[model samples]
Target: MAVSLDMLSLLPDPLLIIIISLLPFKEAIRTSVFSKSWCNNKLFKLTTNIEFNELFFVKSYQPSIKHLQRKAFLDFITFWIDNNKESIIEKFSLKLSMPNNVSELTEKCIAFATHKGGVKHLELDFSDPKWVEYNNVAPYHKFHEPMFALPKHVYDELKGIQILKLYSCRFVEKDLLNFHALKEVSFGWMEVSIFLINSLISNCKMLESLSLKRCWNFSEFYLRDRNQKLKKLVVDNCSFQYELFRVVAPNLKFFKYSGMMSYFDIKGCPQVEVADLDFSTEFGFGGKGYRLYNFMEDFYSLKVLTVCSYFLQVIPHGSDMLRMERNFNIRHLTIKTQLNKSDYRGIVFMLRSCPMLQCLTIQLGCARIWPNYAQPFASAPKNFWTENVRIYECLKSSLEVLEVKGFQGFDKSEIRMLAYFIQSGKVLKKMTINMEKDIILSCNRNLDLNPRKFAEFLLKVPRASTDLEITIC
Candidate 1:
C-alpha cells in the first residue's frame, strides 16, 4: 500500500489535480498527506470546480451543531477562497444544511468566488427546514435573514457567469444593464415576484433555458420574447390560476408545464417541437377546458409530446378520430397515466393528432379523474381496432417501434391491447415489453413465474408484421 501510494505521487501534476478536483473539498485537501512530494503542491491552485456541503464541513446532522461551528466554518471558507483566488473556477456549489445566525458570511463567500475566480456555474442551496415549517412568517422577519440574498451588485460584478442556480434564496432587483452573459437560470423552493422574474428574462439576452420548481407567491406569469433567445422553459409546481399564465416566444422550441389546471396562452412559438404537460384538473374545468387544445394548436411543428389523462379527458370522445383543428407532425409520443378500461381513449386521442407518429411509449400509473361524477366514462368506439386501422394510417405504415412498460402479462385487458397493436402494426420492426415484477431466474425456484414461459406464450400470438423482433425483459 505504501509503494502504491508512492507511485501515485510520481504521476503528472495535471492528472493529480483532476483526481483531486473530483473529490469533496476535505478529501481533496487530504491528498497532500499522500506523500511528502505532494505536500503543499499546486493541487489547490490548479483545481477548478469546488463544492461545499454539510457532509464535508459539518460534524453532525443535528441542527444545534450549526451554531457551534458557524464561525469556524465561515473562517475556513474565507481562507479557502483566498487560497484559490488565482484559480479559474468553472463551477462553485455551496449547500447549507441548516439555518445559521451569521448568513452574511455565506453571501460574502459566494460573491468572492464569482467575482474573483470567474466562476461560470454557481449553485447556492441555502434552504432551511424551518422555512417550510414557518412559511407563514413574513420575508422581513429575522428568520428569513438566513436565506441567501443575490444582490444586484453581485450579478453586475459577475458579468461572465453563464449558468446560475438558486434554491431557497432571494433575487433582488438592481440596475443590471450589463448582465448579458447568462445562458441558463434555475430557481427552486424560493419566493419570487413577477418583477424579479421579468427583470431576469429581460436583462439576460443570451438565456436559452430556464426552470422553476416549487416556487410560489406569484399567481400570474407572462413572457414575451421577440429575439427568440429563450428556447427552453420549464414551470414545475408553480402557483398559477385560470387564464393568468401566458407566454409568447416565437422561436422557442421546448416547453414543459406541470402544475394545477390553469389557463395557458402560449402562442407564436412556431419552432416548438417538444412539450410535456402534467397538470391536474381537479379544479373547475369549465374555463380551462379548451386551453389544452389551444395550446396544442400553437405547436403544429411538434415532433415529441408527453401528456397525462388530464389532457386526454378534455378531448371529446366517441369519434373514430379526435376532432382537431390541425394534424400534428409528431414522431414520438409518450403517455404516462393509469391504465383503466376507459383510459384507452386518451391514447387513441393522441394517436389521432399525431399522423406522422413513429415511436409510442405507454407507462401505467394513477390518473387524476374529474371531481364531479356527472362526467361520462367514455370508452373507445365499437370495434376500436377496426377504427384504429381505418383512421390512424401511422399504425399501418409509419409506426415501427412500440414499448410498453410496467406490463403485467397476466392481465387480459393488457394482453388484448398488445395483441391489437401487434395485429395492426404492419411496418412494426421491434416490440419491447417490460414486466412489472422480476421473474424467477431458475425454473426450479418458481415454474409459474418464469419469464421464458411467458415470452413463449406471447410468441404464439399472431403478428401482422413478419419482420418483427420481440424482446421481453
Candidate 2:
C-alpha cells in the first residue's frame, strides 16, 4: 500500500509551520528532510516561536559527551538563526548552562531575539540542568554567584518584549530603563536587590503581573507605587535578608505569598480581589498571630481567599478572637488544611470573619507542616462540632456550596466536620466529597465496610438545607 506524501503539501504554509512548531525542536528540524519545500528557510522562516533547550540534547548522553553535545546544539541554533534572521519571532526561549565565557554568545542570542526578530516573549533559563536530576535541591549557592549577567545594553532592546522570564541570571540594576511594552516579568533563583526590584517596578509602567520565586539577597521589599499598573504579584519561597515586606500598589488585584511569615505591611491595595497566604514556618513568636490577624484586615476588598494549615493554626483564639471587628468581604474561602484538633479554633475564627462567604472549599491533607515544629494530629472532642462551635452567619445564610477535596474516609474528625456543615449550612445547595483513591485502597485492605455504604450513611445524616444535594466521588 502506498501512502500519500503530498497530504502535508496541500496545507497552507502558515498551518504547516504551526504544525511543525508544535513538535519537539529536534523533530521540528527533522521535518525539513521530508521535502525541499519544507526546508530551513522556506517554511521555518515563517515560524514565530523557537525554543532551544540544552537538556533535550544531553538527556540521553553521558556527562563526558555533554560538552560535545552543547557545541553541536550551539552550532545548530546558530545555523537556524542565520537562515531565519529576517523572521519576526513572537517568543524565544533558551534554557542552557552558561559558563564564565558564554556571555558574548548569550548577548548575541538575546540581540537576535529582541533587535532582529522583535520578540515579545523571551525566557532565558541559565540554571544548571543538574538541578533537576538532584530533585531541585542542587547547591546553587556553592557557585557563589549566577554564571550569566545580562549585559547593560540588552535592556534597551527588551522594551518591546511583553513577557520576560529570567532564571539564574544577574542584572545590572543601574542600567535598567523603562520597558514600555512589558506586561509580565518573572525572576527565579536570582539575587535581586531591593533598589533593583523597586527600579524595575517603577520603570515597567505597563507591567501587569510580577513574580519572584526563590530569589535572595533582598531584605526589605517595598512596592510603594501609588499609580502602579500591576494587577497580579506573587512571591514564593524567596529568602529575605530581613523580615520587613510591604506593598502599596493601589491598582493591584491578585496577590499570592508563600514563604516564611514576616512583618508584612500590605496596604493601599484596596482593589485586591484574591489573596493567597501560604506560610511554611510555624507561628513561634509572641504576637505573630495578632500581626497576621491585623495583616488580613488590609485586604478589605478581597473576594476569594486561600489559606494554608499554618495560617489557621496561627490565628489567635480564646480572648484574642474578640479583637476581630472587621468582617471580610470574601465570597469564596478555600482552606488547604488537614482536619485536626489544632485547626479547630482557626477554622472557627475564619468562619466568623467571612460573614458574606458564598462558597467554602476544604482541601484536606495538602498542608505543608514545618519539619522542626510540626503540630500533633489529635482527635477533636465528641461535642466539638456541636456544642463548641457557634452558628456562623455564612453557614446560616450566605454559604451555598461546600466542597471537601482529598477526603480520607477513616478520619472521624473530618467526618464530623462534614456532618456539622450539612446540619448547619441552611442555605447550602451542594456538598461534594472527593475521595482519595489511596484512602479507598487502604480502607478496602483494613476494613470490611464498603465505600458506597459509607457514602449512603453520610447521605442519611440530618441536613438543615432541604434542597441540598450530596455527591461522593
Q: Taking the tens digit of each residue's C-alpha lDDT, what string does model 2 give over 1-473? A: 97767567777887898887667555776787776678844675566778888877675557678778888888877887787777677788888786455666677777777776377888888887564422112212332367687766668766677898888887766655466677888988777776776677778778889898767877677776644788999987677777888988888999999876778887778899999987744434334666787788787899999998777777643236533577889999999777666666678778988899999999876333333333223434566786755679999989999998878766677778888998899999999988776644643533344678878888899989998998887
Q: Per-residue lDDT for 315 in model 1?
A: 53
Error of 1 at 15 (Å): 6.9
Q: Residue-wise lDDT of candidate 1 within 188-265, one digit each (tens)? A: 787666667666778888888888876766768887775578899998766543347878787789999877655667
Candidate 1 off by > 4 Å: 1-12, 15-46, 53-87, 101-105, 108-112, 128-146, 151-153, 175-178, 284-288, 317-321, 373-391, 408-410, 435-450
List runs of model 2 lying over 4 Å from the truth: 1-47, 52-87, 97-112, 128-144, 151-153, 282-287, 317-319, 366-383, 386-389, 436-450
After the best TM-score superposition of candidate 2, give how far the Cα of residue 15 lies from its true spot, in angstroms: 6.8
The TM-score measured for candidate 1 stands at: 0.76
Which residue pairs show backbone clashes in model 2?
none
Best model per TM-score: 2
